[model samples]
Target: MKVIVGLGNPGSEYAHTRHNIGFEVIDYLSEQESIRLTKNKFNALFGKGKIGDTDVLLVKPLTYMNASGEAVGPLLHFFKLDTADLLVIQDDMDLPIGKIRLRQKGSAGGHNGIKSVIQHVGTQEFARIKVGIGHPQHTREAVVRYVLQGFQGDDRAAIDAAIERSTSAVKAWLTQPFSQVMNMYNSNK
Candidate 1:
């Protein structure tokens, strides 16, 4: 089984914020595939269904972004799945808005959610798809405020497009190898 995790904080207040872009992709995938995220376990909301011929578990951690590993590590352990079976979708402030990048493995690169996942999972060798949110400023405070806020006007349109592309890449991952998916998606950048 393949486990797809989208990192985001819980609660309506964070619904469409830049930091919640991961959750947005999961939501889109769920709707398109008819996968109902009705199960709550390991502090996560998840659903299991078939994506093409692959068995997939779509997850949204309820422990919030900073502590995402609390849910992800346990879930993978309980299912006896390896990190190789995992795919994480998250937002990236380093890339321009609407861009998406896929990596087979890497460090968190300052993302608290990915850092948490790496900590609990005990490795940096897992697939991830990063949707760019664009940096607002160089200061830490400004970065925090920017990520937690919702996108506006043109930014919103760009984000919407990015989300669509992210979902498509995810579906492709279910059928093809991670490296192939990365090559297919990353070359567009």
Candidate 2:
């Protein structure tokens, strides 16, 4: 079984925020697969289903961004799965807006959500799809405010396109080997 965990803060107040792009991709995938994320487990809102014969569990950790491991760790134990079976989708501030990168293993790159997952899972060997949200144009302290804000004007379109592409990359990961998917998505497009 493959567990696709989207890292994001819960609640409507966080909806459409740059930090919630991970959740947005999960929503897009759930909609495409006709699955409802109504069940709660491991402190997350998730849906279990199959996409093209690949058993998948889509998760959105409710414990918020900084403490995502609280949900992911238990789920791994409950499912009797290894870190290799997990795929975390999250936002990256360093890349250009709308860009994405797939990796088989890596550090959190200062992302609290990914850091929490690494802490709980005890390994960085899992697959991941990182969607770029870009950084604020002004002061570096504005990072917090930037991630919490919703996309605006031209950014709205780019982010929307990235979410769709992320959904597609996840779908590919469900069946294709990680290395193949990585080679296909990790390069600049």
Candidate 3:
């Protein structure tokens, strides 16, 4: 079974924050695919279904952002899943808003949540789909505030479009080869 894990803090206060973009996309996917991510398992909000013919499990770890690996590592072990069978979705501060990038493997780039997963799993060989949340300016405080804040006006529409693109990207990944998915989705400028 393939697992798609969306990383974010769990709470209503974080519902619309840029840092919760992963949660938002997962929520969107669940809604569009008619699956309910209500099952409480592996310390996560989860739903099981299919994308095309591929059986998939959608997971949003409830251990919060930084400690996300605690939930994912056990789930992977329980399911006897390889890193290749996992796709991590998270918000990226590097790229501009609304863009998405897919990578087969890489460093976390200072994302504490991804770092935690890498530490627990002892590998960086998993796949990832990063949705850009746009970078904040030079101010340190602004950077913190930017990620924790919700999108407004046009940014909301852009975010919605990105989520839709992510769903299509997942379908493509399941049906086509990883190289094709990478080629098609990596330069999502």
lDDT values for all models: 0.96, 0.91, 0.88
The TM-score between candidate 2 and the true structure equals 0.96
Backbone clashes in candidate 2 total 0
True lDDT of residue 159, candidate 1 = 95
Best by lDDT: 1
**Per-residue alpha-carbon lDDT of candidate 1 for residues 72-128, written as tens digits (9 for 90 to 100):** 999999999999999999999999999999999999999999999999999999999
Q: How well does model 2 score by local distance difference test?
A: 0.91
From the highest lDDT down, the ranking of the candidates is 1, 2, 3
Better of 1 and 2 by TM-score: 1
Q: Write the per-residue lDDT of candidate 3 for residues 69-148, one digit (tens) a residue.
A: 98899889988999989988999999778889988889999898899889878899998889989998869899888889
Error of 3 at 21 (Å): 0.9
TM-score of candidate 3 against the unseen true structure:
0.95
RMSD of 3: 1.3
Which scores higher on TM-score, 1 or 3? 1
TM-scores for all candidates: the values are: 0.98, 0.96, 0.95
lDDT of 2 by residue, 1-189 (tens): 899999999999999999999999999999999878999988999999999998889999999999999999999999999988899999999988889988889999899999999999999888889989998866767998999999888889999999988888888887889899888887766
